[model samples]
Each structure stands twice: as C-alpha cells, then as structure tokens.
Target: MATFAELPDSVLLEVFSYLPVRDRIRISRVCHRWKRLVDDRWLWRHVDLTVYTMRPKVMWHLLRRYMATRLYSLRMGGYLFSGSKAPQLSSALMRALGQKCPNLQRLCLHVADLTTVPIASLPRTLKTLELHSCEISMLWLRKEQDCSVLPLLECIVLDRVPAFQDEHLQGLTRFRALRSLVLGGTYRVTETGLDAGLQELSYLQRLEVLGCTLSADSTLLAVSRHLRDVRKLRLTVRGLSAPGLAVLEGMPALESLCLLGPLVTPEMPSPEEILASCLAMPKLRVLELQGLGWEGQEPEKLLSRGLPHCMVIVRACPKESMDWWM
Candidate 1:
C-alpha cells in the first residue's frame, strides 16, 4: 500500500481540497512539507467557508494566509452574519479580501445587507454575483458610478431582497453581455416596476420570478413577443387569467415552466380559454401547479379528456374538493 508520504503532491493537494477549509488548515500543521502543500494556490481557488460558523477565527486566519493568490470564487455562509458582531467582523473579513483577492471573479453573499460588501475591493474580472437577503436598495443599485466598478458583470441572482426597481436596471443596461437573471421573493416589487424592469434586460435568455404580483397575461405576452429568445421561465401566478394564458401561448420556445400559486377563477376569462391554452403548449415538459382548486365540474375527467398528452404533473388542492384521477 502507498504510504501518505509516498503519494505525489498533486494527489495530496486533491485529497486536501475535499476536506473542509478548517480541516485543511489543521492538517497543514501536521508537518512542514504538508504545510507548504496546503498553501498551494490551486487549493484555495474556490473558497467555500460555509462550514466554519462555529470557528470563524479560523476563516480569518486562512484568509490572511491566502488573500493574494488570484481567488476565483468565494462563498461565505452560516451564522457569520446572524451573530451580534456580524456588522463589524464581516466588514473586516470583506476588507481583507478586497485588499488581497484582487482577481475574484464570482462572489456569493448570504448576509443581511450590503453595507459592508467591501465593494471597492471587488475584482475587475467579476461576472457572476448572488445576493441572499442583502440590504441593498434600488437607489443604491441604480448608482451608475458605483456600477462602473463591475463592467464585466453578467449574471445576477437576487434572492429574498426587499427593494428593487426599474431604474436599477438602467445601471445594468450597459452590460451587453448580461444574459441570465433571477428575481425571487418579489412581494415588494410593484407590477409596473416588475414589467419595466423585465423590459430592460435586453439580452435575457432565462428568467425566474418566485413571488411576483404582475399582470400575468399581459406581462407574459409582452415578454413572449419582445423577449422571444427566452428559453427558460419559472413563475408563480396567483390568479391565472385568459390574457395571461394568451401571453404563455407566445412563448413558442418554452421548454420548462413551474407555475406555482393557484389559478384565478370566476374572473376575466372563462375556464375554457385557460384549458385551451394549456392544451396548445407544445414544447412544455415539466409543469408544477401548487394550491390549485378547480371550481368546475368533473375537473379530473375534463383534464383527462383534454390535457392527457401534455406530460403534465397536476397537483390539485383539497380546498377545490376535486377528486384525484390516476
């Protein structure tokens, strides 16, 4: 059997990479040769410090040792921001990265706000950014001067953010290379802003809105006509209407759709219109409907009659009192 000492340094580095960052640092103390091996630049390429919530001092120590090695990706998670000293301690950590990790390309911030983002330290090579519940605002997001700092920004994921605006998109319009965008937890986003904001994503190919309150039919129709290039779409419409169904019909290239929330009833368009639209969708493969209650008679039998060939997954709600059909 090959002893630990006999293994090649490449093999050792690969093995160390699998271990948690804290564990890798601990192993570095085993011996001088191993310490040097652990310090290898390749070992720190993708830094994910999510597991070190209990011992953040160790994260600080590792960052101090490797702040300058052309870091490509960084994901900082856990209770680091949930603690009492998060604002101060997190700021210090970000400051350290800004001063050292000059080549950072992708960043994921799972914190409360952006007050201490160390934005000035962000690398010029940055392209992808994901913010989870960050305290950023439309005013802050619309600052064109601040946006010039990330000229290469391409993809953005704003998950559970409270404030965003159509004007925020104006700052990103210069990014001709921008492609994918996701807006999750959009209860705060007004229908008008939601519509205007989507119109500005000129090069968008994929879009996802988790909790938006928009005119589903009209907004979707506009997207299908103007943003015909969109191949992937995910939305949750509370009151599905005929106009909204018409909009869905325009998405000729749609392949994957997740329609959450319930379909609106006894409203603008009739049930026949909605059913016809569902039947006409050709490229659709996966369909997820949550909290759906059909008020019409024999819904299961009616669906079995028309929507049998769509390869759909229907999850009707008990509230609708609609019996299941296998």
Candidate 2:
C-alpha cells in the first residue's frame, strides 16, 4: 500500500471532497502540497454549513480561505448575532460571496437577520433563494431601489416571515423570471396586492400561499387571469363559495391543486359544485384537501366518482395549531 505522501493529487482531492468543510480545512494543514490541493475550485463546489450554527469569525475565516468562484450551492445556518454587530457581519459575508463566488446558484439561510444584507451583493447568476424564520424588519424588503436584483431567480421560498406584507410582495414582482414561489406565514398579504403582484409574474408555473386571508374566488380569478401556465397551485382559502369553485375551469394547464383551511363545511362551497369543478379541469391529476372536515358526505368520494382520471385526497390536519415556527 502507498503512503499518504505517495498518493496522487487526484486521489488526494477525491478523498478531501467527501470530508466536511471543517475537516477538509483541518487536513489541509497536514502538508504544503495538501494545503495547495485543498484550495482546488472543484472541491468547494457545494458547501453546506447548516449542520451547526457557525460562528461569525470562523465563517469569515472559511469565506476568505475556501469559498471560491466555482462554488455553486451554499446553505448557511444563521449566526448567533445581535444589535449593530449583526449587520456588519452580514454585509461583510455578502460582499465576500459577491466578490468570490460569482457562480453561486442556490442560497439558503435560516433564522437570519436580513435587515442590512445588500441585494447587490447577491450574485447575479443565483436561481434559487430560501429564507426560513428570518427577521426582516418591516418594509425593509421594499426599501431596495434596485428591483431587478436576482432577476434570473426561478424559485423563492419565504417561510415563517410574519413581517412580510403586500409591499414586499409588490417588490418581488420584479423577478419576472420567477417560475415557482412559496409563501408561508405571510398573513398580511391581501387580495389587492396579491393580484397586482402575481399579474406581473406571468412566467410563474407553481405557486403556494398559506396562512394568508384571501378569499378563494379572488385567488383563483387572479391565477386564471395572470398565471395561465401554472401547473401546480396550493393556497389556504377563506369564505370559499359554491360559484367560486367554478373558477378552476379557466386553468386548463393545472395538474396539481391543494386546498387548505380550517374545515370545509356546509357553510363553505357545496360538494356538487366542487365535484363539477374537478371534472371540468382538463389536465388536473392530483387534488388535495387538508384540514377540511366534510359536512354530510365527504367530497373525496364525490370527486372520485366524477373524475376517474384524478386522484382526490382529503386529510385532517395533524394539529389544530397553525404555528409557522420551524
């Protein structure tokens, strides 16, 4: 067997690829050639620092040493930061990401304070962005003058952001290339802003809006008018009426739809109307109803009878709590 020193550069780099960023950084100190080989661009293509909450200083050290232009995907759990210091660290990190990792495509951040993070520092090539339980100060998202930042982004997931509102949704309209968007815990967005914002995203193919108070008819009308190509849709509706269910006929391309709310009662839309709407959808194959307790007879059986081509599922929510945390 060959010794560590006798191993070829390709063999050494391949071994380092499987190691965590911390371990790779540690092993890079073993020898002069190992230190040089560890900096190879291919070795840093995909970096996930989410396993542990990273320290700011250590994150800075790694950014300076290992993050490179070849890095494609990065997921960093939020740093435990507070007050004035947090913005400085975020700005510095974003600047390094902009300056070094020009090819970064997907970025995920959890529990981050996004008050001072600059949109300009985000790489122009980025295609996907996900922010979970992040603190985004009220209207801070709409304050940016550059509306087209991340213009190429195709997907965005904003979860558990209570401060996100109509103006923030309006700001997102600039991403004309957006194909898929998910919004959870955004309770402040209403029909007016939701309609205006979605009208601009004509390319949207998939959309999910939960914990918002929009009526079902208005939401479906907007989707039918603006997002004609939407193949999948999921939204929590309020005060869904019988005639409102007929709006599904306008969306011929929809393949999957999920309706969610407290419960589907006799007070809500009638089962016959819903069944008729299900049969009208041309390409629909999957229909999911969650947290909706049917009144007399379950809508599932009625829909299955009308739509032999569609799969109908009805589920009671695991818990009554709509808490968006975690």
Best by TM-score: 2
In terms of lDDT, the poorest run of 10 residues in model 2 is 80-89
Task: Give per-residue CA lDDT, model 1, range 1-326, as digits (tens).
Answer: 99999999999999998988778888989999999998889988998865545455766667677646548898866353566764333555665666677777788877546655545545556688887767663445663645456678778887766666556645556555677777776556666665566677746877776555554564576567556677677665655577676667746666666555554455544445645776666766555454455444555455446766655555654342221110
The sequence of per-residue lDDT tens digits that candidate 2 reaches over residues 140-186 is: 45735566688788999988776788888877766767889998877
True lDDT of residue 204, candidate 2: 85
Q: How does model 1 fare in lDDT? A: 0.64
